[model samples]
Target chain A: MAEIHLDGVAHSYLPNPTDERDWALKPMDHVWRDGDAYALLGPSGCGKTTLLNVISGLISPSHGRVRFNGHDVTTTRTEHRNIAQVFQFPVIYDTMTVYDNLAFPLRNRGIDEATVKVRVHEVAEMLDLVVHLGKRAIGLPADAKQKISLGRGLVRSDVAAILFDEPLTVIDPHLKWQLRRKLKEIHERYRLTLIYVTHDQNEALTFADRVVVMYEGAVLQVGTPQELFETPSHRFVGYFIGSPGMNFLPCRLTASGAEVAGQAIPLGGTVLAQAAGASVLEIGVRPESIRLADGGAGLTVQVRDVEDLGARKIVTCRLGDHELKVKVSAGQAVPAERATIQFNPHLTWLYADGRLVR
Target chain B: MDKWQNNRAWFMVLPVFVVVAISAIIPLMTVVNYSVQDIFGPGQSVFVGTEWFKEVLTDRRLHEALWRQFLFSGLVLLIEIPLGVMIGLAMPKKGWTASLTLVLLALPLLIPWNVIGTIWIIFTRPDIGLFGATINTLGIRFDHTASPLDAWVTVMLMEVWHWTPLVALLAYAGLRAIPEAYFQAARIDGASAWAVFRYIQLPKMRGVLTIAVLLRFMDSFLIYAEPFVLTGGGPGNSTTFLSIHLVKIAVGQFDLGPAAAFSIIYFLIVLLFSWLFYQALLRVGTGEKR
Candidate 1:
C-alpha cells in the first residue's frame, strides 16, 4: 500500500559506536516497493529483527532518513506510521474474546463499530477463525494465538504494511505451511505490502518474492531464491542459502586458470581476468555441480563416504587435503573407492577474499 | 515411558508431616481444647459444652468489634489496592533509579509493626508530634487521645502508611513480568494510554493483584499491634478491632474460657472470608462466556 525508502540507515545501541562491532545494524540503503512481499533472512543475532524494527519505526535509527513515498517519515511514531507488526511471541489481549481481539486495531483508530464488525468477520473468515470468533482468546493453542495476532493486523484498513518478526516460531511444524499459505493467499487477495523477517531459509524462499540475506548486521545479497542459488553475490549467501552449503577450496591463480590442489580448473576468461589481481582466491562449487567423469577424464580422488538421501547419493571425497562432495543419482555408476570428478564450468565460481570474482 | 510404582516415595514425605504436626497441629489442638472447657485452676476444669461460644458470640461489644474489623479491612482494601497499583505503574521500569526507588518504597514495609506504632504514637501527638502540630497549626482540631474520630484517623493513617508498600511491591512485580512486545503491539494498534492499561496491564496484573488483595485483607482483618500501641484501643473503643478485643479478654481480663472461644470463632471467620474471597476472585477471572 505504501513504498518505504531507507537512506543511509545505521543503528547502534551504544552511545558512541566507534567500530563495526558496535553497530547492531550497519549502514544500508533500500527501497521496499509498494505491494511487494519481501523476506529478511538471517540467523539469530544477525540484525534482521533490528532492521524490521527500524522499518516499523519502533526504534529511531542512529543515522538515516526513512521516507514513505518520497516523504520524510524518519521521526514518525509507529502508530502514526500506519505499520502493523506481529511479534515472534504472540501478544493477545487474553481477557477479550477473539472478536474483540481482532476489532482492537480498528476501534483504537476510531473506526465505527459497524465497520469494525464487518472487517473483523472478514479477517476471521480468511484466517479459518470463524468458528472461534465468539470465544475468549485465552487458553487457546499457540498456533491459534499466533493466528489471532495476525488477524489483529489484518483487521485494520489503514495499515500501509504488515511486518512479521518470525511470527511462525511458535506454530506446530505441520501448521507452519498452512499459515504460510494463508499469508500468501492474503497477500494475493489484498496486494498488501508485507515484510517477513525469518532466520529459516525455507520459510524465506517459500514466502517472499525477494529474499534479502543478511550476515553480521549487513545485507549480503538481495535476490530471488533462484538467483541466490545459481549466482550468489556473496560467499556467505552461497554458504547460507543451500542445504549442505557450497564447498570452498583455496586455489592459486595461474596464467591459464586457477589451480586447486595442483590441478588446473578451467574458468571463463572474464572470471580469470577478474581474479588476476586478487591476493586471496578460492573456488566455490555446489555438490550438484560435481559429476563422475567417464574414463578418468578428471581428477581421481579418494572417496571417503557416501550419504544416501532417497533418490540421490552424495559421494564425499578428498583431493589433496580439500574435501569435496559430488552429488550423483542412485542409478549412476560410481567407483567403490577412487572416483574421477569434474566441476561443471557453468556452475562453479571463483571467489576473491570471500566475494565473487565476476 | 516407564511409570515408577514404588511406594517408598511416601517415606520421603514423613519429615514434612512431622514438621506440620509440631508447628501447627499441636498449637491448634491446644486452642480447641481450651475452647471447650472452663478452667477453674491449672489442673481443675469443667466441660462447658459450648456455653462460652454462645457468650462470646452474643456479646454486644464483641459484635461491635467484629463490625469495626470488617469496616477497617474494607476501607483499607478500597484505598490501598488502587493507590498501590498507581504507584506501581508510576515507578520507573528499569535502571539505577528504579532500584533506588524500590529500596525507598520498601523502607516502610521493613519496620516492625510495634515499632511503627510506637513511632506513630509520638509522631501523632497533638502538641509534640510534627504531624499533629502541623495539623493544629493549619487551624484544625487535632488529638488522637480525646476524640473517637481523631483516634480512628490516626490508626487508619498508620495502617496505610505501614502496609501499602507491600501491595505496591507485589503490583510492581506483576507489571514488570509483562513482556515489552505487548506494549509495542499496543502502540502499533494505536491504543490510547488508558486503553493499554485497561486491556493489557490490568489483565496481566490479575494474578499478583489477587495475592495482594488476599494478603491485605487477612493482615488488616487480624490487625492488632499498630492500633493498640498508637491509640491503646482508646477514645471509647472507636478503634478496638476484633483482635484487640480478643486480646483484652484473654490478657487484660484473663477470662480464659470466653477468650479461647473468641479465638476459635475469629479463626473460622477469617478462614471463611478468605475462602469466599478467593472463590469470588477466581470466578470473576474464569467466568468468561466462551
Candidate 2:
C-alpha cells in the first residue's frame, strides 16, 4: 500500500500546454491515502481516465510531481511505479492460456516457477477462473477474458496500487454487479490501494470509499457518497451526482428573503441567516427534497408529466416557467392539473455563480 | 425500412462466382487436358495414358528443381517474417511520419514483377552496374552471371526487397487494431517491454503473421521472373528454381507432355503446403490449433 500525492499535476498532449485551452487535465493537487479505495467520478471527457494514467505513470504530468510512499516518481516509467491497471476492455493475452496470462507478470519479475504456479492459482481462484486455467484465453467470452485481465492485475501482491479505468463498462449489466462485489471483497481482504474511474455514479459510490468528483478536467470535490449528495461544492457536482439530478431555480437573495419568479418566498428565520447578502444566488434542491404542500401554502406549479419508475415515481412539474422534478414512492397520488410543492429548505442549497454560497 | 432478408444474400455472390469460373476453372481444365496427352504440334496430339506422369516423376532434373525451390522458399520466409514485423513495430504510429513511411514502403510493392527482374538485372551488371562494381572493387569476386552462390544471393535479396513491405503492411494493420486499453493494462500490471510484446503484441499479430507467411511461401516457391532474368537458370543451372525449370521444359525445350505433368505436380505441392499452413493458422487463430 502506498499514498499517492499529485502535487500540482497537469498534463497536455502538446508541448508547453500552449494556453488555458491546451491542457487535457487541469492542474490540481490531491493525495490518495494508502490502502484507501477511491473513485475518480465524472462524465466522459472529464479527464478521470487521464488522472488514472498519470497515477499509473503511463503519462508524465506536464507540471508537478506524483509521489508514491513519499518518493517523487513523476518521470519514472510505469513498470517501476508498481501499478496494476484493469482497462475498460479485457486486455489479456489471447495466445496464452489463462494460467500463462496470470503468470506472465510474475515470470517477468524472475520469480521461481513454483512461486509463479502458486500465485497464479491463488489469483485464479480469487477470480473464480481456476476451472479455466488450462483453456486458452482467446476462446473465452468477453467477461471471462476481462476477469483474466483482473486476475493478471491482482496476481502481483507487491504492487503499490491497482487502478481500474471503467473496467465494468465492457461487462454485461447482469455481470457488472458481481464483479464490483468481487472487487470490493478483494480490496477488503488484501487492503491494496485501489482507484476506480467511472462515469457511473452507482458504480463509483458503491465501490470506492471516497469519491473524487471531477468536471471539465478539474477535480470538484473529494468526499463520501452521502457528503456529495448532502452538500455539493460545485453546481456541476449537485447536478451530476443524482438520478433525475438536482434542479437549480433562478433566484435573487435579499437581506430578509429570497426572490423567485416575482414571488418573494419568506426565508423563514433559519434560511434567512444563510441567505444574507449573497450577490449572485441560485436555489438548488434535489428532486426528492421537494414535497407537495397541502392547502396551497407553497409555490404553485403546473404538473407537466409523471413518469412511473416502478420503484419510485418522478414528478415533472413546472415552477413558473422552469421544469422541476420531484421523486416520490411508486404509485404515489398527485393533485390533478396544478399543485403546490414546498421546497425543503434544510436540504436545499444556495450557489453563487458555480460555487456554493457561504 | 423492411427488415433485412438473410435468404436472398446468395444472389449477391453470383457475379463473383461467374468471374472466378471463367478466370480459374477454364484454364485449370486446359492444364488438365494437356497433362494427359502428348502434343506433336499446335494442333496434333496423341493420347498418352500415364506415360508423361511417369516421366516427370522419374526425371532427375525435376527432383533437383524441387529441392532448389524448397531452399529458396525457406530462406525467403525466414528473412521476411521477422524483418517485416520489426519494421512494422518501429514505424511511427500517427501523423505525417506514419503516412510517409507507408508510402515509402508501398513503393516496392507497386512496381511490376517483371520490371523488378529487369531493374535488378541492369543494376547488378558486373562491369557497369553499381552493386556489381562495388563488390568487384571491394575485391569480393561477386559475379551473379557466372557464380551460382552470387546468383542465389541476388535473387534472395531482390525477393526480400520486393515482398518485405507486404508483410510489414499487414503486421502494421494488426498492430494498429489493438486498442490503447491493452497497453494501459500492461502498464498497470508492471509488465516489462518484452513480456508485453511476447504476450499481447505477438498473439494479436498471429492472424496477420499467418497471412504473411502463406503469401511469402507461395510467392517464393513459384518465383520465376527476377532470378530468371538475373541468372537465366544460372551458368550451370545452380539458381534454377522449379518455376524456371518448368518454363524451360514447356517453352524452351518444348517437352510439352512431361512439362504438363510436372506442372500439375508442382501446383499440387504448392496447394498442399499452403493448405497445411492454413490449417495450422486456423487452429491457432481459433485457439484450438495449439
Residue A143 miss distance in model 1 (angstroms):
1.6
lDDT of 2 by residue, A1-358 (tens): 7999999999888876667777878989999999999988999998988899899988888888999989999989887788888888888777788998899878777889999999999998899999999998978888898899888878888888989989888888999999899999999999999999999999999998999999888999999999899888888999999998889888876666677776665555565666566566787889989886434678888888888999998888888778889888885687766888888877877777667654
Q: In model 1 chain B, where is the ten-residue run with the lowest total lDDT?
A: B1-10
TM-score of each: 0.97, 0.94
Candidate 1: TM-score of chain A is 0.97
Candidate 2 off by > 4 Å: A266-280, B1-14, B284-290
Best by lDDT: 1
Clashes of each: 0, 4
Report lDDT per candidate: 0.90, 0.86
The residue ranges of model 1 lying beyond 4 angstroms of the native Cα positions read: A293-295, B1-7
lDDT score of residue A358 within candidate 2: 44
- The TM-score obtained for chain B of candidate 2 when compared with the true chain B: 0.91
True contacts kept of 1: 0.74
Give the Cα error of residue B50 in candidate 2, in Å: 2.0
